[model samples]
Target: MAIVKMEKMHLLALKSEQSKLMQTLQKTGIVEVIDITGDKKEEEKQGHKEDRIRDEIAKELAELETKLNNLKLGIDFLKPYSKSPNPLIYGKPDVKKDELSKILSNETKIAESLQRVFDLDKKIAQLKSEESKILNQIDFLIPWQGLDIPLEQLGNTDRTAFVAVVIPRKSKDKLEEKAKESQLPLDIKVIGEKRDDLYALIVYHRGYNEDIQSLFKEFSVTIQDFMGLKGTPNDIIEQSKRRLSDIQKEREDIKTQAQGMNQDLFNFEVLYDYYMVEKDRKTNTLKLFDTDKSFYLQAWLPKERKSYITDTISKITDMVYVEFTEPEENDDIPVLLSNSKLVEPFEVITELYSLPDPRGIDPNPYMAPFYWLFFGMMLSDAGYGIILSLFTAVALLKFKLEGSGRKFVSMFFLCGISTIIWGAIFGGWFGDLIKIKPLWINPLDNPMSVLILSFILGIIQIFTGIILNGYKNIRAGNTADAIMDQGLWLVLLTGLLMFAIQPLAGIAKYVALFGAIGLILTQGRAQKNPIMKLASGVMSLYSVTGYLSDLLSYSRLLALGLTTGVIATVINTMAKTVGGSAIGFVVMILILLGGHVFNILINILGAYVHSSRLQYIEFFSKFYDSGGRAFDPLRIKTTYVKLEDL
Candidate 1:
């Protein structure tokens, strides 16, 4: 049965009667103009005002963001000098009043010290980069390929940071012994009393594996704990003493501000709030229609489609008691404007989420079938289908995403499964060996079957449309005429398909010939249009070519499936041939990896596009209405503050 998507008029009126229409609209979260374009503006005296708290907080957050940006700039300016080559000492945060004052009064010294420390880091990083370049070159050889070893087992995990340690200061003798055994050269430095330890910092001259902890453990480096003293910078002390005074003043200002809100500042904010608000403000009204009741009925239609009112609303029902009049003129305002021909999908999704209670059911309940069918047909490759469905399944299970991305992903998963079934029926196992005998003939070898199937599907969906039209007619209280006009068309199309005009033979043709007669007599029965009526009836026959062409398009789905499988097969074949030569083994492996990856990427894209095309043309045309506004409530929104909180 075709679905009717209409609400009972009287019930809809009841919903709008109690609350302010403007408030309900504002709550929708759509960007809207504040001007009272219509007479539905809020009543200022009663005070059911929109929440300003969130907006105010949002404004304050924006200002804070600007200030934070400036603060970052100031901090960045002092960074270069603070990162000089000398290391800086870390002191405990000052707790005593005098000690805290002293540190605050020496911002120049602090900034300078910090810069020198950064400089030291840069120097060390540069040295390490050079050392690693040489190591990488040496490791390019096969013998060093699996030589990653750990240093932690040698007991060195707790040190601040150590590059490399040569063992035994006099390891000259020990190193000589090791060199003799391994045929490897070593350079060791003597250190400590009596030069008993022949250890030198190897500068980790090789790159520090960025994954140092793993490297330490892997290299089996022993950490006998740290032994070095904290390094001091003797050269920077004089410079720090000379630059203290000017920075001290700036530091004190920063300190005072960080100490939190004072009474005067808090009072100033309250005063500012008072200065901005008015104790008495006038009200605004948005009156859509104000007049004595009569035969007229006002519709809150898609404001853009107001021009099509007479045609759409008039045909939907048979209530002579109600009539629609033109909306009263108003100044131009920016808002969605559309005539009845078409509405975008975004708007359709939106409408589904909102809309009040209705007598006629929403069309959404019926579109699911056409949607699923088209989705499956477009994505009809078992291989891509399996991947798409499984990927979406994992995402859905692991995380809850929302809005367009979520809906799109969900659609892909659904269509993918459908594609899998279609692929199976077509005997398309990623273009595996073509089957000679299958439950359904493959699209490649048997194009005629797919064409016929496509036609059958079109007929089925069109029949569904006809049935729904009949239901809409009957629901309007013209049960007999609904059957005559709508039911007659269904029988007419069925006769054309089944009887084929040949079976009807002579006298039997008389029954099939009644379609136009029925339309001429009954179509627009309220208005006289005999010739035009018959013409409208003939329009149904115009579908011969549309049906032919659209059905042919379905074969593309088969073509795409074939492409995905054929390409993968070709890649494998070429790669295997290349691998046959002794010297070509590695090259063949690379070719195999590169070819399959490329094929998978391209096929995935093709599957997505083909699948999407089916939904848009075949399924959506079947009754997939897509112009509803989505319902969204207010949400807690934050950007930087929460991210920076820690």
Candidate 2:
């Protein structure tokens, strides 16, 4: 597997054929048009009026975008009242091109329906707001129900002034005694008493209004007034209740109308996709160079698709000129990965790091095996594996997932299979529940073996990366640099590893010595000063520490594997300890189910994160060249409905 080969394409066509050619290209969805008019000198030489054409296309695109946005807003407003489909069911509704055309032709009718729904929603919201205000007023007036006088008339009298006030229950007696001691002409009547305050109505002649105000200030009484209210408390309460009922009924009627407009939602979706397709088509046209009566375009196409594209263009028009040539050596070509189906899912990981350089090799196939092994080793449990595999399998089967979604689910499915294999080898079926004999040593019993295995795997991956780097160098005709930079280290590192083991120490020392001498001689060959060259070569030996650190990092695999088993065993023991009675058994079942599910989720996340970390930081550091741009082809971009081929 490698990066797909691409050819640079140049096309010239008459203005009459430009629209037909663009439409065909968009439908084919394989050509990534590039603008050729870069500098003012080139634009003047070509005499192309791209700016005006671009402005026209941009205006059309903007209008389409506005229409699409309005349709989306309408859909969101009606969604609450409409019948929602099952969320787990994925994939856009398939609509034929003719059907989409029909929907577009009825755009005015659709817009009217959306406007109607929007107006109804606005009215319903206003009614609900009014209803809420009335309900709050009803609550506030509940304690004042006993008052028989109109609220407005309480404080409005030519001869006498009236006020409703609430005084703290504890201070009411003292205030009344003080008022009597002053021989005030205030006529006070207790209206209502809540837990903390006594509501009272006070009436006085207009001449004593000042005295009544001063008495209220001394007692810290709060005067209550309902501004602009003309009816008694009970009368207003009945009117508010009736108004709330009417508003609620109006809202229900609006909701019913919205429910009946569900068919409009489907129509809106089709139109949204149609407009999106048109918008993208118009946007792509901006990339073309246009003259007064002709247009020219450049693109990069897959080498294999050149024939198909040529045939399609020939069918469109015979007046167009198309030429394809190999990309220049210095061309910054976009990269598209080519891989077998089994290796494809791992491309997601590669893309996350960054796509491989167009000239560089695809790393997905190389990285897939290591990623699979690492994930399974970190989350080693057969039961958890079974659950993960089954879940992803169902999702893959039930939904028509595309692009990154399909790759993500498929990658996890493969990881689950690996987990099952490792779990079976370790004899871990839900933390010792099955008690089957292990094909390999149990990590819990002999963790040192597992740790050694992890280190061995790490060493293999790191060395594999170095070897791949060497291969790349060889292909680039830099064999000496490859040998000096990577081959010497491969030998030296292998010797160091062998020397660490007691059995190979006698043979390994000499091998390491030879590698060291070779590195000293060749690692700093470019330095002219002899002493500086030797010093540089000596300093280069320090990179062994980086390799050592990378190898030690794999110890996490053993650590995580042990943690999963221990937590699972603890869950099992806790469940069994409380499972002696009937009720206890039910509790135990719940604990067993929920506890294991939680454990699986946490460990799975850890596995994915750490596994990706190793790939990104440790393994890919050896040979990957990032920063390649992705291939973006002209195509129909839809939101709600999937359009059939035109």
Candidate 3:
């Protein structure tokens, strides 16, 4: 709540003491420093470099993850076609990076091969689908001995609706006589038609298949002519598979080569890791010589370690540099390198839910508890609360999420806790599961009681913020403002407002007049100018309305609670009706699942958003600097490979 005053440190320290302080500060973080004056540039450069390294690591990890995703899909698809149900058992449990890269390359090539095969497969399938239609059309032409449909004319060509049987033009009248008596089994499109001498051009289908090649071959002579140029699709398909196999074998060899390189890369990385630690231990170590970094340490360690080196080191170390101050503030909070602010509670929950990433920002300390309370308020049904807690626990324990999924699940858990309490108060759980109805009517049944409780809660929370603000302000040495502008004024105004609108208690009348007079007098001194100060006093009196406004805004809590209970009641009634019949029972199951899920989602969102609004507008307006930087400690951050385990 309050910032602790830092005792001005002056100290003569052993080289070791300064180093320990630096390490301590590193653990806490850089952002907590009001000012960093010495060797700032080097620190900045180191920080940037660290960030870049982390980014590179992230990029590589993302590539690995993507490859893993593709492999998963490929594995799923190829499962039935595979040599065994467990391809993983056929090989090593983990693939080396180089081998993985090669595998990915081959995976791409194989996918392309599959595409080629699929396209051919599509053509073949379509040909098979059209088999009956083509056969039916050509059925009549089958018995025509030398009436001759040439295999070469099998594709696209036009035909006249009827051909005259005459050998010369003089026999055209005979053709017309034959046409009048016969009909041709044909498909035609008449291109041109005339009246006196009917003229026409027509269109029809010509079918081709490889099986027909042998029957049509009698029309040709030489070996080249006998074969013609018929391309069979099966031959192409087999050839593609062969090429794919060859490519796969080639990829295997490349993988073998890459496997050898993997060791070299690993060794290089391990060696680099050792070098970094060694270098950090050396260059950044404290020395007896005066340095710019404003840190020194004093400790009551055993006097034996300061033996022969102590006297000589004292000559180089400043003679006037010793001071004693008790530790505060940072002692309790666990420090990390990436802390940037009062890390939100939401972020903390995220950390709890997911695998910790070194580079991630923690917002959990700030956001979680409030977020939970807000969520509970939004969905004030006990049944929903119990449901949320169980569901979240199952999900978080079962199939864990890596990033924001973890945060949300954690948030639900916290919300569930709050909801349980509120639900008990509101007589929730399908309207009192244990017949533990609320002492007072539920928010739905008694709106006034709900509003009154909401206001009281709001007042308590608001005052809590004010008290915290006063503490911080006074500690930060803004005494005048803490007393006049913040603390005194808030107390006075809140007191007056509470007393003015109450089931007037014993001291209500006395408290209101005292609070009002104090507010009017103190608020008058806020401005330096006489005229402005006078007007400020006048506004202070009018600010009774402002107090009313703040108190009234809390009614939204009731509104939200009412909204949840009403929605649940509707769902419950619907579920009862649906459970009446067999079909209805099935529908009820779906409705309950879907409706409750939707309700949970919507209410959770509403609670969080509205709660945050109150905190920012009503609560935080009291006193929150929100400008303090988070403590950051310099350290290696890793996820997949646990360091202690390693």
Candidate 4:
């Protein structure tokens, strides 16, 4: 399987049939409408009229989108307390198209329901704020409750000023003695004594205020005032407590009312899906050309589906004209990959790098086997593999995950199986819990062997990349260039590899020498001057060092595999060290479970990152023709509901 072929399509329809035609195409969800209006000059030349009907449709769609967003916000706010039958269930409630129309027509009622929830939220916030203020005031007034005078009457008299002060408790008697000695017209009344301070009220003639302030300042005194408060401190405190109780009750009532509207969440979901479809239909029309009585549209669709699309459009209306043509060689055709189900999950990895150019080969099928093997080798734990597989299996079966989400989980599920296989081969059954011997040597016992295996696999992947590049060149009718660029290097590397082995050294030396001479003579064939060509060929031979480095990059696979086993074994050893008394055994169980789980999580992450790095940096850098645009079909993008086929 490779990139799916695409064909350009042009359609002409009467203005009256435009809406029906667009609806049909959107429902089919296979075509990608090309933006003909992107070029200002081309748009000016065409001079297409802006249809008022489309403008009105756009306005309506915008309003609908806003309404949907508001409704969703309200639904999300209430969801935690909604008490659904099964919160883990993923599918949205189904509703017919006509029922959706009916719901939309009653937009006023839905808006009112959403507004009610919003109003309650706002009121609850205000009530909470008020409650906090009241509680703080009560705490503050509790310290001043012993004063018998009303706070507002503290300075009511024109001739007298009243002030509250806190002085060190030990100095209360001294302050009284000093006040009497000063002979100021002031009344000193000690209200209360806290741990380290005495609360007092001082009433003095207005004229003696400055003198009294000076006297108090001489002995460190903090002035406390409850300004703008009416009635006695105790009365005010009681009143605030009552108000706080009322606010709490009101807040609870508002919460109950908001929770009661949770059933409307389903309605909101339906409307959200409805607006999404409507928005897509309106937005797609912007790419169309419109006249007073007709509309012209252009799009791209899969070539294999041309007949099906034609038949579907014909069924919609015979008045519309459709034409399909092959895309040109130089055209920027969108890429849509086609692969067997087994290989499809790895497309997630390829897509993250870049889509293959329409003219280039799809790399997913080529990279899948290697990626799976690398992931397994890095993780290399049978127990972790079983856990990972089960976790993903439950998620896949329990949820309706789609698109990238579904592919990602499926990829991990497959990787888990690969991990299990590698684990069994390497004798990693939960870090030697099972006494079964390894089919292959354990990395801990013989790390050099594992490292050698990593390099060997790396060499194979590199060779595969080179072979694929050569194949691509051959298909493009550049056999000479392909041989010089890929084939010569392949031969040279193979010869060198053979020469490294003791048995083939004698024959391999001559083979490598022959390949080296061929590369030196032919690598710069396109150059004009002999000296420059030969110099360039000599420089090209230096890339052998790069190839060697790429081979060494795979050593991380062995490193990670060993790291996982060593950490797991450490966890087991720690668990065993603590196993003595009953309490010690229980502690050992806790430590073993938590430590192993944490180790598994950390190792799995390391395995995924390192494995992906090898593929992306070492493998894909070879021959991937990136920068192709992804195929984005005109389709319904639902947020809450999946639309069933009509």
The candidate scoring highest on lDDT is 2
lDDT per residue for candidate 2 within 1-646, as digits (tens), equals: 7889999989999988888888899888888887665633743754335566677778888889889899898888777877746334766778887887787788889989989977987897788788888888988787788889988777757888888888888878888888789887777788878999888888878887778788889998889967677788899999998888888788788888888887898898778777787777777677777777898888988999999999999998999999998999987798888899888998998888898888887888899999999999999988789989999999999987889989999999999998998999898888876788888989999999999999999999999999999999999999999999999999999889888889999989998988888888888888999998998898888888999999899898999899889999899999889988999999999989988998999999999999999999889999988888999888877766788864
Please provide TM-scores, in order, for all candidate models, with all chains considered together: 0.44, 0.92, 0.51, 0.90
Worst 10 residues of 1 by lDDT: 276-285
| Candidate 2 wrong stretches, greater than 4 Å | 40-52, 84-90, 135-148, 156-160, 165-208, 211-222, 233-238, 329-332, 525-528
* Decoy 1 TM-score against native: 0.44
Q: Alpha-carbon error at 27 in model 4, in Å? A: 0.8
Per-prediction tally of clashes: 56, 0, 23, 0
Give the runs in model 1 whose Cα sits over 4 Å from its true position: 1-365, 433-439, 475-485, 499-511, 524-553, 565-579, 582-626, 635-646
**Superior by TM-score: candidate 3 or candidate 4:** 4
lDDT by residue for model 3 (50-126), tens? 45544554565555455434434433333333333231223212335464445435554545534443453454445
Better of 1 and 3 by TM-score: 3
Off by over 4 Å in 4: 40-54, 85-88, 135-149, 156-160, 165-205, 212-227, 231-238, 644-646
What lDDT would each prediction earn against the true structure? 0.44, 0.86, 0.49, 0.84
Tens digits of per-residue lDDT for model 4, 1-646: 8899999999999989998888889988899998876654654543434646657767887887787678777777677667654523656555676777777787788878788778877887788788888888987787688998888877637888888888888777787788889888877787877789888888888888788888788878778867688998899998998898888788777767766866576677677777778778888887887777888898999999999999999998989899998998777799999899889988898888788888888988889999999999999988889888999999989987777888899999999999999999999988876666888888999999999899999999999999998988999999988898998888899999997699999889888888898999998788999998999888889999999999999999999999889998988888889999999999999988898899889998998788889988888888888888999888877766656542
> Between the candidate structures 1 and 3, which one is better when assessed by lDDT?
3
Candidate 1, overall lDDT? 0.44
User: What local lDDT does model 2 show for residue 309?
Assistant: 98
